[model samples]
Target: MRKTLLSIASLLLVAGNINATNIGYSKDEISRNNVFRLGSTEKQGQAMRLSHAKLQALKGKTIDFAEFVLGSKNVTDKKMHVFLTKQLDGTPIAEGTVEVKKALSKIKWTLDKPYTITGDEDCLYVGYTTEVATTYKVLMSDGSYDIEGCNYGYKDGAWVDTYGMNKGSALIFVNAENVGDYTDAIIAQSNFEGYYKAGDNCNFSACFVNAGTTDITSFDAIVEVGGNKTTQHFADLSIKPKEGYSFDLKDVDTSSEGEQSLSVTIANVNGAGKETDTSDNSVSANLFLYPKTMERSLLLEAFTGQDCGNCPGGHLNIEAAIKKTEKNVIEVAHHVGYKPDMFTMSEDPTYIFFYPNMSSTFAPAAMVNRNTYANVSTTPIVSATDVNSLLSTIYYADTKEPYVSLYLKTTLDESTRELNVKLYVLPHKTVPHNSSIFNVYLVQDGIEARQANGGDNYIHNRTFRGTVTGNAWGYLVKDIKAGQLLSWEKTITIPESIHSSYYADETKNNVEAVLKNMSVVAYIGEFDQNDNNKHTIYNCCEARLGESHKQTGFVKPTDVNSAEAEQSVSIFVSNGKVHAGGAYDRLQVYNLAGAQVENADLTKGVYIVKVTADGKQTTKKVLVK
Candidate 1:
């Protein structure tokens, strides 16, 4: 029960008298005649934790506005500033008493770390003195700090301030323009008919009408079908605008199946690369994206390696086509054998270039998303029902108009285990005139290996460690832009053994795996330099993720049963005994980490129950007892 963070620090001053370093203060507080040095001096001893002041006594008057709660117990970059010493009590004579914007809304900072003070500068520093007790400490260059709060409020005029609260930023847009068939006149639409489950409910409305003159302060619209493209722009855009906008598709895997790629980006925090004026007033939309459909989404690509012994039955037929598509298949394993696949050479080169065009020379083969085999001389070779009947004949073919449209921009440089990728290749239409190569794939999410079959273990997901065109498959968009759109950039290196096991497993590693869940999966098909899949398109797209929700809230189990006491004595014996009418009158027992073992305010009985989890517990008595 410790979650309290409220901080907003901005202190700027010091364009002159530089060169000052004494470290632990008191040299007359660094020879003050007017001093303010808080900007990189190796984060001066970062340590801040002070919040003990709340002695309420109102009605008889006694309210205190003296609140201070700043943080940092280590890993310094110091930020919590203050400085405005110009005599109000010690009569300093010259100016500078402290207006720092009237103590910037009454200084009130607090954050025991985890909102992580961002870049370009300004994390914390607020100095405002009239000299009563001018403290100091803010020296950062990765030395982390901020512990200086002086006071002198001259009747709320200004002194020692640095307040908080400004969590406002959102801009998202997903589906725009596809508004025709309201299928029976609106109520909800994003077009989905019959078989789509997981809570089915939908809506879509858009009308900014035009922002041609452009200068919107807020905007949002996102209709992501599933995952990747930075997990559909950081998880289905709950809106975030500040030089921020997204339209992801690189190496498509919107939780895969067939035909689903919609992108409409429009972000504005002062619109970053400009040009968004949809003419004065255009931005309108009613929204909702809970369209859950299932019946198909199968495509399993596992090239396999780690000295393939039939790559564990092609990793058990891509884990039985993801439990026979209950998880709706779009599985990519791609290790590419003859060694080096400790998870895609750790980063990529998609198996030294799709391993002899995936000849696998026979050892654990696959390709559901790239359509292969059929005859390629089978062996202990490629068998998961022959990759599930080549995934039921490419899920019944018939999905076009998206030859290949992938674009991505990744950035991560843990002091250079550097992960810099910027790849784009959009061509929903138009290709011919020697369409070269451009295939990018690098998928790594949660790697846990150890399977010599029998020792089992295998926790691999979206795992295909690396491949940046050095695998003979592709990477040559040389002078070609028919449906125009091509880009390239690469810089990977997060393999110092996955960065020393994620900095030695930073307590189960997560900063969303250090920046929005690692991803890089690009595909443009038919490379070995053109065999013409015509108008150019062979998309099966991979790199997927979804299903990681944790809510162990209510918990209440100690082995209770009758099947949970005959379903709580048949809901008070089918409600007749308790007689109220219907709709559950009483009977409660919840657990699955949602506590509340029992709550009975009944009139009719029929009891006996018990349940427990993770340890094991059970009990069951009878009718209302």
Candidate 2:
């Protein structure tokens, strides 16, 4: 393969030097992927699932410049107006206004301005139209999609497509003489951590900023290592403007290891000012030394529900930071999440297709391993207080170490209720270039429910019981090596249902909850329709479906409205019938696990009916046949 793609482009040109060549379609391609936002001053205006930007992946290709890469999750810096339309309801062949202060953004706007696109439906629409700094996002895609210039909305200047653009695919990186430079500063964050021994000394850290409008009093931090290079000048420091100035290189030397290239730069102060864009000074990572011990774990998902009253104080600050830092942490709650409570099961589109806001707009939000939180705000969400403010941030993922090492083992039959997981992955290092996924999730425990204050006997535990590879984004951890060992075999169908309609009385189909408090959670993160910090989490484990033997039932709880729309109630399935009007009043069905069955003949899986009046009750889940 051309000498393995030229020895991986000669180890990324010995690691740093940002722009691998002046080109487009890659600012890590519309980074931080998403949390799905396009102007949300509170909702009621959304679209851009395609506003027309058809370069068809740059048909014949030609470009010197073209920029639009946004990501200011829950934005607030203000001023955003970017476009390039060609039809989705057309009218903007070029537009401007971008200046939203960082949350991991890259607003190049328009530079060098050279364009050329041709044939096969030539389209072009790179978006961004605001309503006072809401949350902006880009770079998202799933399954089959072709470049849908997404989520447009900018009244008072035309450009409206606010339809229900919730399928995914956004993050357009259009460029030519390329690689990013609106005044640069690299080494965003990188370090392999620990043992290299000999003379020790393997450290790293660099922030340094000034992203443009030149004016840097002085700077220097270059560090290479292979052909050797090291510099550190700081003569008279300044740096304020856009703010960023962290430092620490600790002299890196790690004697000699199996793989090493170490690069991190930020220079440009010899004569002070005049660094327009040295390709972001530089940034790269890789160092693996080997020769001994390494252990790591972290899969905490926890999106929480029960009608969030600050989500039971983020579920009592994640069991008080896992019993005061026993930290090996492997939780996976993903309940109803970010709004709706009553313990949302697998509902809300598989936890908003991987937490649309899984890390706090509020809901006890958490994602210790669904990654995010490295360069901060790239997208793991994070925001669960208490427990000493979450023991200084979940023990900082237990001080690093996890290139890959997920271990899972499950096998439950209990009379064909089926479940057969088996994941073992173990990379240890080298296997990241973004594009990995292996979530398993099928949790359950004790069940008790209700928790605006965690009252109704609150005991939800790990909850989230669905997706045994039934698509909560499973598979895609490809043929990695280093201790090889990879396996796959999913088989789930155990959803009786539960999301508050708390039964056990009116025969509402029995469900006091407790499938031996099932458990299966797995992990091995990284995903990027353009790097949302590659969703982080590189290892995880969980396996306790009653140790594969013993069992029990009527513990079905999982399901938050299917098509959204349930602040209290409103469900309608049709044909086989299952419509529980707003406030409910006696209905009853059950099945995925609850038991009441026979709602006079309904088929096709997933049930969880239950309704009632007077004493109060309400729930929904239908899949009819």
Candidate 3:
């Protein structure tokens, strides 16, 4: 998904003349990663409409040719029909047909007679239609980087906007000519940290495209923030037509606090003052600055499965990286991508949707902090072999401040096999309502499982058990104010089935859920209801059951401790006996099956100790060793 939406005011204007130039929707090179089609035997087609702003420069120009790219096809009878229309589903102003030949090959159809643009029409539609018997995928692209007025799929005789549906734009373009000379530079994309701290030096970057016929030799970039402007110049460069150059501006001042709007503009193209098209020369973004910085604990959500032969390498690489950095890194291994195993939870499939495209959906892949780190892949998904990139991202992300801080506490009931968790969210700045979520995951360590290459009885740690928040995307909260403390409590029942292996006739039992080996991981992240790829974690923390954990961010609210002390009931194990402290009305013990044990001979194992004080109840897991 695009980080920022491009409006008509941000679209580049192109000149059309006798010197024909290819015009299309995609700004990047087309690399086939996935394919799309309506259905077998059904006419599959894709179309693009030139925006009014883009057509202004070509008002009187003519479209001489229509070109398109297609994926591999088996049927020889399928013919691609290309058409140009003033309106969708309208009579074609110009049409041509070509035989489908090779894969990833560009097929062109020279119009019998050129169709001139009147500039009165709202937009010009260019599309191709074809029918296949069994091979339905007729079009292909890298991924869904939707742009308005582009990426329309024809289905059931109606054009549907496939935005956020993974239906990438069809590789179709037109050769328009007959206008005049023009110079234009547009910011195709921009990047910067999501959040920053006051007084920190921020960095910014953008991809500038030469949208005109003239080559760009010199240019200037200006960044404005907080009423201050900084200009950077570049010279002795040659950027040809339809080409892009990326530039980075480092150490921009970020002294202003609160959410600040930053704008970047391209100026003096070829050192000839402003270009003819200025609408696309500038882009703006919002960045938040916090008064203080918090120490961040990164979260690594890994995708793997028992049947994956290369999965063990991913585990070793992650473990080695953690040991080398010694950073507080919390990991959750999801049993997905290759095949489902006993550890595969109901929500595990949903996590796979976090992949930017179908190509990156594979085992031995992981998302660090759910962020697209600088110099890394454009998407959050990274291969396990890129350990250095992973480390660099971890270090870079750790230096940045989070918008909110997370604190977690967990209590386990061995008898009822329930885990209770309390999550506290402290905001450093005001957060918009329904824009973020809090995710809680139950992960266990020391599980013996079969590994494709490492042999049976492989110890799998940080195995995802389930979601404590019920929803895989987490719980959404209301508007939050700075210094406000918000908390959520949830009770999760642990199933006994987790202790057994359910992988391909492998009968392994007694893989106990050791109390000391289990932990609850929680984090706060920004959520986009429309696009999962935009979700990024803000902050995270982990807490083990029946133990104390500490994290640095905000001071723990004293009122919470006071309230707990007033109704506190301490349950502990010592000298092979379960001890209960503080005043209590009743006390009892039970086994893992929720069965009460009355004065039974105890052994070296685990038990659930429950106590009721002043009508309030609490449970704790006790281990006798």
Candidate 4:
């Protein structure tokens, strides 16, 4: 069903001819724009697929306007379809079909309504569809660090994820905040526990705020706890009004392990200058430093996808965990390492560059709190055949008191298509590490997509759509103090043109599932600078999204048999024939990297396949073309 996009593009906007902000790539990211299929180009199909190289970075941003640096040649078909589609599934998002009589330079298309994208999937497609093939030139640019090319195509029925490599100078402008100076310094938050280990040199910090209202040159900070005081004089902490800085007490030892209280005071306000409010200078939070250790909630980073045959078992265990002790676990399902997923956050710094460095290269694998669970290697995760054993790992995590507690408050305006997220971080103890960070992500629930083992009707949840603001690990909220209260507010637009959920019937209203299924998840933790035990999710919590109840929906997990594991199945290829053996109930073939490939006329290469019988699974390597 080829549907025309609900477009809001205008033909007249070049009043003064201002240069559009190039959405392809930044100067440092990739600084070159080349003309690919220029003036002589014409539509080869109904739609000419275009990919913006760095479009994923604009995931949570607003797209009010866009520019296409192209010249329209002599065209018979005046009607054109200009649109944006999801990179993973090539689902059309925003678009405008307009007619042109004369050729022009630097054509511009403005959406009547702004498009707010939640899933900045594989690509940001800027394309146009024409029923009658017409002449049009498509712009191009250099390959970015993240993408090989910047354009794509959709024909017949299926979409080519990497159809062709091309770039375009399609500049998309969004409503952004202008930067200003920093002034008004106020005490924000600190991590002060009530108790601590004897002789424990705890991490303590005080967060300071200086927006542009005042000219705060510098400030002196003092962290006192357990009858011990640590004073640090900050020289030039010129902070921006839109941001705050954490001042710290790195190694403050506790007098004893019984009870440790902390208070953070800011003297020399604005570098000893006069300030109106002396009352908001000091702040403190509670913490308990146990003699041995404290209980911390387990963060289950489940790497799953519909294409993973064995992932069903992992889901069963996670569902059990959710039913058993939901608070004891915070599950984040990363839909990668299989097929290109609609919810995979490949744009995330932690996902693209960090988490993979420490996790296994296989699906159905999990990182329990992003740490070595059961003393197993980060790679080759311990077997998860037993749900009880997998559930028991939380015992260790449950024993540790969270060093931080996060609270969330959100207000959504459906009429204006605006989403406002408010985050509050309360520190329990001073974690003096300089590399502390808080990551808040928006997740969608109940996406009915294809799955390898659970059939094509698998539902995905806790799917990381993108970051709240652009920060995956958040800003420098934890760089200075552990037990301080850090508060932040982010306003993002909800795009109307994005794709709807696969199972739209399951949703009560709203075609776009992101807004309805969105959930705000926050985690305040520390990263080990030494690369050992790196990227740890200390404490985590979630806020139910869409208080406005504006087309709200949630995808519940499907029930699977927990008493039995996925049955064993095997596959082998011989004499150009794929064979399924060993109690096999289903035979699924894939190329070496795990993409589903046809079995009839096979290619010549090492291929991995899944053999499943009665939900049981096994993998085998074979040589096929």
Best by TM-score: 3
Query: What is the descending TM-score order?
Result: 3, 4, 2, 1
Cα lDDT tens digits for candidate 3, 113-132: 98888777777888887766
lDDT of 2 by residue, 115-211 (tens): 5545354445555654433333432322111112233444444555432343233333444322232333322323345434333455556453343
Per-model tally of clashing residue pairs: 93, 29, 6, 38
Task: Give the per-residue lDDT of model 1 (tens digit) for 299-336.
Answer: 45665555556566667665765565453345556554
User: Candidate 4 lDDT, tens digit per residue, 1-625?
Assistant: 1111111111111122233222322111122243334222344222222223222323455656654433343444655566666643455677776664443343466787777654345445555543423333433232221111323433444433322242321222222111122233444333353334456665555554442234455667777776678777766544433234665575566545434567777787665555433454677654565434333456776666666778888788767865676555767776665544444553432552333354445566555655545344543133344566556555544544455555565666667666666565555456656687677777777877667777767777777666777765576644545434565656676666333233234333232545667777777666754563555566776766654211111111121122112212224465566766335577778886668977776768887777777666766677764
Root-mean-square deviation per candidate: 31.8, 23.2, 9.7, 27.4
Model 4 residue runs over 4 Å out of place are 1-297, 322-327, 352-360, 379-389, 478-483, 497-511, 529-532, 547-625
Per-model TM-score, in order, reads 0.24, 0.26, 0.62, 0.39
Please identify which of the two predictions, 3 or 4, would achieve the higher lDDT against the true structure: 3
Over 4 Å off, model 2: 1-222, 228-258, 263-298, 301-331, 334-395, 398-402, 405-417, 422-441, 444-449, 452-483, 488-520, 524-537, 540-625
Global lDDT of model 1: 0.33
The candidates, ranked best first by lDDT, are 3, 2, 4, 1
Using alpha carbons, what is the TM-score of model 4? 0.39
Model 1 is weakest, by summed lDDT over 10 consecutive residues, at: 180-189
Residue 147, model 3: Cα distance from true site in angstroms? 6.6
